[model samples]
Target: MPISHIEHYNLRAERSMLETLRDFYVTVVGLQVGYRPLSSYGYWLYAGERALLHLSEARPGDPREPHLRSTFDHVAFACTDLPACEAHLRNHGIDYRYAEVPATGQRQLFFSDPAGNGIELNFAATPDS
Candidate 1:
């Protein structure tokens, strides 16, 4: 069978960063904190009913050190209300960059999460964006 859409992306962070990461995704990225059921310390981030991101707590001297230090170039989600999104970013004092697609008119907001994972909020082409 052909591959379908991306199910989710998982990230492991220092145990202390778990809550901060959850808040960042909820506040800055606009995802809802949802039930994980997988682990007491795990988080499942949802965009509506679709679970798009999973977070795991890192152990002491977790062997996955190298991967966690890598910056996420970005995780993108189709979005709406460019102005509102921009306002939210500013209101939260988060650093970000925005641009428009010259041909398609799709607008993009680029920023980093609290854990330094890059995030992109994409708004579809509209008469006014």
Candidate 2:
């Protein structure tokens, strides 16, 4: 059998960072909190029917790594209506950078969340535009 797509990605975070991550993803990234079902503290963020992002609380004894440079870069989403996205970000006072992909004409919006997690919004050009 062939794998279909990425099911989800888990982010291990300290307790304090959990709420920050939650707010950013919910308010800015446009995800909804869903059933996680884990005994530990954290969240499962859903985009539509599938939970795309998972958060797990790091215990006191868990090793904490300095994120001077994060090895895992950013999560990207394909979105519609670049104008609306820009206005939403502006309304929220979010700082973002925009660029068009080399040849695809896909517009990219890059920004960092409260906990410094990078996110990308890709807006593809529609046909007959």
Top lDDT hit: 2
RMSD of 2: 1.9
Per-residue lDDT tens digits for candidate 1, residues 1-129, read 899789899978876677788888988888998878784577999999989999888877784343245535778889988889899899999888988888998989998877677788899998754
Q: TM-score for candidate 2, please give it.
A: 0.89
The lDDT of each candidate is 0.83, 0.85
User: lDDT at 16 for candidate 1?
Assistant: 60
Candidate 1 clashing pairs?
none
- Write candidate 2's Cα lDDT for 12-69 as tens digits: 7787888778888899889999998888899999999889999888888895442547
What's the TM-score of every candidate structure? 0.88, 0.89
